[model samples]
Target: MHLESVVCFFAILSLGSIATADPNPNQTGSGKQLYRNRHVARQQLLSTTTRSVPPTQPHVTPAPTFTPTTTGSSTPLAPAAYTLSNGEAAIAIIGATYAAGIGGAVLMIGGTAHPLAAGMIARITGGGPNGDTPEVEIEDSNPVTTTSSSASSSSSAEPTPIPSPYIILFSPNATAQEIQSVNSTLVNHAAPNSLSEVVSHGTGLVVFFKAGINPNQADAIRQAPGVGGVFLDETLGVDQLPSSEQAPLSFASRRSIDTDTPGSPKASVRNPADIKLQSDAVNSLKVISQPAGAKLTELPGYGYAEEAGKGVTIYVIDTGVNAINPEWSSMPGHKDILYAPGAAKTKKDFLNHGSCVASKAGGPVYGTAKNADMVVVKVPRHLHTSAVFTAILEVSNDIFKKKLKGKAVINMSLGHLIPDELHSAYEQLLDSLTAMDVVIVTASGNDAEKGVNDVTHYPALLGPTTDIIVVGAVDNAGYRAPFSQGSGIQLNVSAPGYVDCANGKAHPDTQGRWGTSFAAPAVAGVIAVWLSQDEYKAKLQVEGQVAARVKKMVQDLAYSRVEGQPPVIWNGIDPRGLSCASDHPTGFIKVFEKDGVASGYYDVSSNSTTGGVTENIEQWCLAKCTGPCVSVFLYRIRQSASDGYYICNQYNQPWTNNLVQTGVAAADSGVVFTKSLNRRYCNSPGKTVSRAS
Candidate 1:
């Protein structure tokens, strides 16, 4: 028993030496001794059982020294490693074993167990196959706060695009099915509520894209069936320039010659004996009738047809018209003023431009065709291409529905520069309207100051076409206005641009407005007057013979004023014949005379019995009358005939016989001598007339 005890004691001493042994003999003794002292303290505090095991080198390299951070600094502390005594290392293994056993119990108790505990056990136990030491990585636990600079840098990765509007025009021959298909494609690719039909006559549409369109999407649309062209929808402005004050008298004061003032002469006096003196104002109205170099005193007042545009309608496609103004209110009925679809409901002229335009066309005091009807088609202040297209379509449809084809005239005092494709679309729409015998008159745009040629402006650009009559501006002296755009070839006619027009304020107030906007309306009024005549109306009703004749007549009768300017528009009256007593009487008067010798009378039945012959009665009288002719009468012997026959008599003296005595004799003899049928002419109020029987 004594010998066994001595061997066991030796073994115990050997095991103690191994537990306290230092594996790295080359390592600094101070670090090893400090680590062992800390392990001993930790082992006493844990109070866990320990087992002997051989020490191994750590798998990871030794980390740098850890430096604690201050409160103001956010730098994380570096991870560190330390050597442990054999006994303390054994105690760590035993604690890890206990944790593994508890984790197994948790797994058996509940199915929702975390894998973190198992993962820790695997990391602690699973070293290299060659028996290398395991490592425990300690990541910095401080929460990180993001900076604004980094956030901004991350946010600026992508960019957004802007939207734009475009117009899609279909081919003229494109079928309705094809148009529908193209529209469907646009709706699929375009932004919501962005597609709209602009002009049904030209088959055009407008669409907007909020997110902007890519090249691929545009190409797809272009490749669609029946798509003629796509163009950017551009905005336009009114054609009027800035207003100026240049009138000598107000509209009310200029309306009549103040008879109360007698010799004071508030206004110029028109020749009472000379018929066709419509207005007393010797301003723009007088100049239209006089020749280029005539003195202001020699100028006659405005001369127009007897019908005075009675059957014609002037469509003023502009801003809007104030129907309540005296210029329009004085007419028989206020019902002549009309608004196009999509135009504003308000009758007030916001810009006061359309009212002035309307006044120059057919106002009671300052107009050309004093009795013509006016239709106001309103547009936005800043005109859009789509809005213009829609307006034109509305006008065309209205005229066709009301059967006011040739009797209608559209006066467009607005224009803008447009693209080629858009120009084509306009041409298509206008061509259609003109085919129906609707005359279109437009202003030569007021873009001369901008160096823009009148031919470059739309509607005016289409002036070269026979159906459209484009007028440029000329001052009162018959010289082209400084701002008037166009060469003589580009413009169809010229008219007084500077004129005393309605100010669109209160009733009877006037302003001296200047621009081609005023000139075009005057020409429109003249066309209205010409159309009111029976001969032109008959020509309009004939198939294939449209407004071309009317357009030619206007151009042919226009007289040359300034050398470089277009011929100024005339009211189709010869100033030389104003005081004449030819067969073409000036006013609405009739005369019938029977010579005592029957051989002196010339029968005109073989020439022309149509009512149209009355327009050229002077020429017929000159050709058919044999001897010295004093008076000519148009008579239809047959009561059933639709037109009258001309009878030129050589009676040079006036006869004083009552019409009732002639009618009673004609009824008893079975011969009907109707009242003399001469072309009716307009006369001023309270004019004396002398009829022969």
Candidate 2:
């Protein structure tokens, strides 16, 4: 530590070769008085270093210390000044001369000082208070002032500098009185009226500070009793410039290619023997088979009539749904399709976008969740960032007013710039929607030719929030659609956008409907299927829990065209893991581990509508453990008591790497199931289980 110096000048009297002097009254009011003031100031500054300022009454206390020395009559004798290299050197120099009453007299220059310097003085002694010393302000060769007790006082060590116009997140438990105290503190120290836009959501409040306050104010705010955390209100915008690009496919009837074709590069129809039919209206249209003879169909749910979506509400936030159309009005739940007042109350599809999207969501014949109802939210033709934000807020509030809190899914096919400037606000809104049990689904965009990244869109690239799911379009041939935009980490899954529909026909069709716009609704419709089930409906009761589970179930069960590519969602709503028989028990679970080795995975099975998981699976690994295992997965699964097979599984596998090295159990645990809900079964649920050597 460098020495902090406090000095004074005195007049010298020469009676011989040697010189002696008395304190000059002009320089300081009586040397003894200056000494006492300096002593108090030094004590106060050091004592207050670890103390906090009172929020209600913010004030600075003064401490000062003074000293005097003998000098020649015409000239004052300068005190000995030594510049040490660092604080430690200054301490050593002062410690060596402690007997001379010059303890702590080494002037620390923040940096190191050299004794070999020409103008440096080595040692000198004078009378003064000896405890923690005051920081003496030296200006124009005279000692100006010597006391400092405020929190804003500058020192050799840097403090947490307060950034102006920053946001403070108050603790969840902060009271109104504590909030008032914080306001008083800011007013007294930073500025008279430094705060703006104080908004509260749930238990948290977001407030802004004025610009150009003392940079050290952040430290004070952090130390304040009521504040939880503080962050700078940064402005971030989309890196890619916004463009008026068109979607990959325009509105038209579905592609009507005959099952038999010759010399057509894209045509690859299934054989007659493999084609499965449910009714005349719903037929299993297989386009591609991966392992050569393996059959895949568009309408995969053939006989599962009980899985029709029931009591699920799909919000189509798109270019207005036209209710007057015969295709829409004739649907079972058509009366339930409500519209936002600003989006116009009439049933009019101005762009033919919302109609196609709504059909894909729940249009009875063409929809994924056959029985789910629809709520149309129309966005403006030419979108603005502010308007879209306002639309989200307005729609959220509308949902709240409508009392559609849980089991409500939002399907947005519109695309907008995710400017870097609005990342915080956008994130805050999405998080709020999630906490309220509302799930938002948005398209990954259709700008693959333009080389646009998936996250370039606002809601789609809103990062990894459990409540938002981003979808990309895939063609009938089980390949990623050439025009579908691919994302970095946020894209959840892909779905069929190329549905076969007849032109000028009464039936709803997805044939000509392409782009991520149509793809998003397909996934939304699939989520509606999950919501319809009593098992998933119970899970949806907990806000922000089901979206992650849905994504996981799809990831575990869905087939992909190529490895590492996003897997496409199941062709039909009733997949083996999403539906169940009466005897197939389902439950929720929380897994735990021992030193990254396997421990216990507890399963809480729900017996009634109240909801719970009652069983657990305990796994024990034989040594080879080295790291820690995180508590991942919140699941709802269907297991057959006799066969020990996981029939319908819905769980969240956190997208993080937990395994440190290779082992038999180190593979994706998501695909694994157990016998008797314990380690002995060694079975895989979604995929085939194999033994390790």
Candidate 3:
């Protein structure tokens, strides 16, 4: 359908449905009839007011030029009187009036007093008690219609008459000359076709005919040899476009702000193998956890204590960081920060969201990795997925061209649900970046309502890949924040997303903000610290193995606690687990569960390596116990061969590595039995051994 027709159809439909409660009894006609009459009168007014152009010539709108203006608030224009057609008096009302609240009065317009139409009075009064009052009372229950011609002129008038342009799509092989030839032949010599200066290259051409395209003409154009398809050229005004592209940013004053002095990391670094929990949340635990209630400085290594993130470049794809501020400028590697060429250098964060996130990642006082350098890629404050995709591609291309693959980590705390068509392109771009060994971290989104219902947010949903880490927000008590959106296989971890905006130097604003947005940067900063480590860099140098092991390494070191389910607290920088690990399946475990007993088959080759390869599990259990108790099959995989794997009881208590054997069941006579392929052979898997049933 044509856009004009569609709009008109909706307008008509809307006008016909206009209803009000307790309409004025004095009203002359139904709203629909009155509105139709007003519309007709408006059409007459437009015909008399507008200047007509030559019918044969195609009208072209000039490109608009914008002049920057000082930012300030302005008062709105008040409604004024306008003369109606048929030389009738039209009283202009500034606001609203109701029937019970309004009474008939002399409507003075142009030095003359005229009695108001019942329709006009009913519209203005909105079925209220009569009284002598000029004051407009706009009730929430019933809206009053102001009879200001200037206000309703545009809405009531008919759209301008113009020949609708057609977008003709040509086959790929069709040349420009052939398209032009077809265009020329489509219209007669007297009525030439008006082709747009902007060509669709090998695809299509926008053509407009003076006489307008009839059904026969359209059919003929469609049947043309190289023409693939034809569509209406639905055009919009420059003003109708999204304001993000048109608006100019007004940056904060260029003055250096206070810098956050660096602090020391935790005294001892923890090893991943020491952590035994394997819940989804455990993948993101830090050694010195961000305390349930503690300042950024108080949290263990929260202030980039680990390697200062040196040699690691954090590509922050956000509202560009306000590096002009001393908090960023005072940093050791602040000089490394960059904005895309030709991008506005107003090193001030207008939205403050970017600066806040950047601080969490690398700002000296507020950051997790104070020493890590950052590339601030300024995007629109209100991000569009396409703009984000473009920015990522550009940054990724730069990283590849400059050979900064494993040396960098990309922090994208912004994303939205996009169309299905864009998903493939978006994922492809991410795959390309990850394939280059760049670590990607993104938020699970703040839309918890949508998330609980299984609405997956993108980029976070882009993978089953280990290269990208999807983080969600967790509270001080280590439970998913009520506002955080995440639950499922895609959620890689959770972190302390809470930040007191009032306390931090990076965000100089009123109150604070929370969500997965803040949580993502915390993870990114830790990755930056990991990247800066000498050992991790050495592992990066040998092929792309390090990128594949990042997820497992994170899970191993994660500090886990069970809420409804376990929530992992993302503490900053665990240097212990940043080792090269392979994905070879080295061993298997057989799970045996009956009654209240939940135990898994645990066996491995004597030579099988620990912490790197996948440990498979085989399950065999009685049908009754298998239904509920077997649902949770968790067996601790110990580092020492002597520490045999054990299972959690029906009570969900932590089981001892070896002594917690022969579990008790809730029902009498239902014996809970547990066994494993002796811990001695686990560390060095000599051969695959079968467990005796």
Error of 3 at 545 (Å): 3.6
Query: How displaced is residue 250 in candidate 1, in Å?
Result: 15
Instruction: Indicate the worst ten consecutive residues by lDDT in candidate 3.
Output: 39-48
TM-score between model 2 and native = 0.43
How much lDDT does each candidate structure score? 0.49, 0.41, 0.40
Highest TM-score: which candidate?
Answer: 1
* Model 1 TM-score relative to the real fold: 0.55
Candidate 1 stretches with Cα past 4 Å from truth are 1-163, 198-216, 237-240, 243-276, 291-296, 333-343, 447-456, 537-545, 562-565, 574-693
How would you encode candidate 3's per-residue C-alpha lDDT over 1-693 as one tens digit per residue? 000111111000001211221222112222222122110000000000111123333323221121111101121112221212222333434342211101122343323343432112212322222233332221111123333232232233222223344444454355556565455543321122343222321123321122233232344466656665544432110000111211122111121112121222232343322211111111122322432223323222221233557777888765556655544664555444344322345766544556666766765444556567777676543332323433554566557555776778888776543333333334555665666677888777655533342324445655343357878776544555555665666677777655532122343432244666667787787777777766555644445555566665555545433325334544433333121111211112233333433343322111113323233321111111111222223334444544433332332222233323345432211223223222111111111111111
- List ranges where model 3 is wrong by over 4 Å: 1-306, 335-345, 381-386, 449-455, 501-511, 538-542, 562-566, 569-693
The TM-score, computed over Cα atoms with residue i paired to residue i, of candidate 3 is 0.42
> How well does model 2 score by local distance difference test?
0.41
How would you encode candidate 2's per-residue C-alpha lDDT over 1-693 as one tens digit per residue? Answer: 000011000000111211111222112212222122111000000000111223345323211122221111222224322222212234322222210111112343223331211111223222124333322222111112222211211232222223245455455456666666555545443432444333333223322222223333444466666665555432212112112222235221233322221221112321221111122132212221121223334322232223445566788766566565433554555345443323445566545566767776766445655556677766544333333444555555555655666667888776543333344545555565666666678777666656544444455655344446878776654457656675545577777655532111233423344567667776777677666666555545555466566656555445554444456665332221221111221111233212212212222211211311122221111000101211222222223333221112211222232422224242223322221122111211111111111
How badly does each model clash, as a count of residue pairs?
A: 0, 41, 25
Q: What is the lDDT of residue 383 in candidate 3?
A: 31
Instruction: Report the C-alpha lDDT of model 1 over 366-474, residue by residue, as the tens digit.
Output: 7777767778777654445555665676677667656786788888886643443454556666776777778889887565666655444456656664468888877
